[model samples]
Target: MLRVMNERAVFGEIFRLGKVSRPELAQATGLSKPTISMALADLERARLVRPIGLRTGNAGRAALLYEIRPEAGWVLAVDVGREFVRLALADLVGDIAARGDERRKGGETPAELVARLGELTRELADEAGAALEDITLTVFGTPGIHDKETGSLQLAPNLPGWERPGAIELLAGVVPDTPYIVENDVDLAAVGEGAYGLGQGVDHFALVWIGTGIGMGVVIDGKLYRGAQGAAGEISYLPVGEGDPLVNRGRGMLESVASADGVVAQAARLGLEGLTSAKDVFDAARRQDPIACQVVAAESDHIAHALAGVIAVLDPELVVLGGGIGVQAGDLLIGPVTGRLRDLVALRVPMIKASTLGTEAVLLGAMAVGLTTARDLVFERAVAQAPPG
Candidate 1:
């Protein structure tokens, strides 16, 4: 019992401080020199901590600096989207080692995507000089809700063949026996923002993602509110459109007017023919094209209408605009959206900001989640293996 307690104390300090000498560990853990020494020895024997080098202070002798063995385990973070797949590998201490991204080919099925993810994972592990089995945890960020019961993705029409049965199982097969999780891309983005971006220090915030798809990630009281069935932030289906809500059930009214596809459709309606992508529309608007500007204005109004609904209900402290279009066209959207929102909502308008992390937000969120899960898994296994008093 005493050994376990001492071990946790020493390990916790090292986990937080990154590196520490015996004397420093004793000071931080409030333990005696002998206790700290023994704990350190045990941790080193367990391969959890290692002596990095020497720390020479203006004192009697040089103290040996110890750090958590970064190679003790690894974490894999994967972000899967219709157009691209990004993978990042980090150690137990959250130090990233390898990062790779691949543009997914058009017409790939979910099975093919899973295979691509597995290939990417192995490639990343190779770059990190680690094996797949060494990865302690893997967190996959994807668009749409992960239906735990059916083990399949739901409301993810963008990814072809993703809703098929055993989809989650296919993902799990990629990292067999490793602690694996599939999460919503925008939800992960919200976590990324909260942990490292504009949402930091704000207890209540929402991340609005607009691009190939539209979604929201809500953070309440510093915790992600996934809601029943893990579909809390499906803002795409919000009943705020002029069209018949019933007919637009799958695509949602707000999404029909606000997402990239919606923006392109609006541009086409405005006589901006041959606009291949939403970026072209934004570029046209930048050139002050009358029709493009009209479409952008209408899109901004739709965004504000949807945001008003979110602000009215959640009343978040800040709302972070993310995704390709949200961050790129921020200057174009913020003013018009805020103005329309002010007209729509009686409550105070939430502070709106653009995502600083950009496309990497989801990957960072995956790393955050993976690190957390790996640490807990390691500690839990250690505790369980300890002898009872």
Candidate 2:
């Protein structure tokens, strides 16, 4: 027990400080020199730590600097989107060693999609010189709520046949004995923003994603608040209209009026010309076209109503706008939405900003998730492989 505790102390110090010599580690962990040596020797044998280089500033003789070996394990991060499947293969230290992306063909079956994901996983692992079984953690960012009970996805209409029984089981069966996770894409975006984007210093924030779909990712006290059954941030179901809540269960009332399809439909209703897509509508609004401006204003109002609910419930300190349409059309939406939200919600409104990570938010978030899981897995392995007390 003492040996395990000492090893944990030394490893924790190294993880927190990045690099340290034996003497510095001893000083930081408050462990004796011989104990530190033994702990380091055991860690090295377990392939968890390695000597990096000689410390330069020392006097008598240069002592060796040690760092956690990044190549000790691997993490696979996947972003499964409606049109594209993006992946990043990272090391234990969270450094991306390889990346690959492929566009989804129309009418592709669920089996085909799973096969493509498996193929991409193998290709990336091979490129990084890793075997499938060697991957320490695998995280999949999908566009729906993962139903842990049935082990299938829910509310993911974009990925057809994914909700069918035995689909998720098949996907999980592809990689045996590996720790796999399925997370909402937007939720992962919030995680990514927290680690590498605007939510760095803020403890309480909400990430609103508006695209083909609308969703929010809530972070409170610096941790994700996944409610009962992991549906905490499913804000699309907010009743902004006078309709019955029971009638608008599947794809929320707010999402029906504030998503990309909603924007395009509004533009079509306004008789906007050459507007075959939502981007054209936002572009027209940017150009100050009267009808396009009206549509954008209405969309902004709808989004504000949705955010009003978010603010009222979570009272987040900041609201981050992400997804394809949210980040691109932030300039046109922020002003009106902020103005309207101030009127709808009684409390102080949170500062709204566009995402800086852009399309890479979910991908980088997958990396963060994988990195977290990898750290825990590595530490557990270290403890289990420790010499018997």
Give the number of the best model, judged by TM-score: 2
**Cα RMSD for candidates in order:** 2.6, 2.8
- Once superposed on the true structure, which residue ranges of model 2 sit more than 4 Å away at CA? 27-30, 58-63, 241-250, 385-389
Q: Which lDDT tens digits does candidate 1 get at residues 1-389?
A: 78888998898799889878898888898899999998888888778889999877667888899998888789999998768888899999998899998998977877787788888888889999999989999999999889888888989877767787778778886778887999999999999998889988999999999988899999999998899889999998887765432233468777877888788888887789989788999999999999999989988988898899899899999999999889999989998898888889999998998999999999998888888778767766767865564
- lDDT at 361 for candidate 1? 95
Clashing pairs in 1: none
C-alpha positional error of residue 279 in candidate 1 after TM-score superposition, expressed in Å? 1.0
Question: What lDDT does each candidate get?
Answer: 0.87, 0.84
Q: Please report the candidate that would top lDDT against the real structure.
A: 1
Single out the weakest 10-residue window by summed lDDT for candidate 2: 241-250
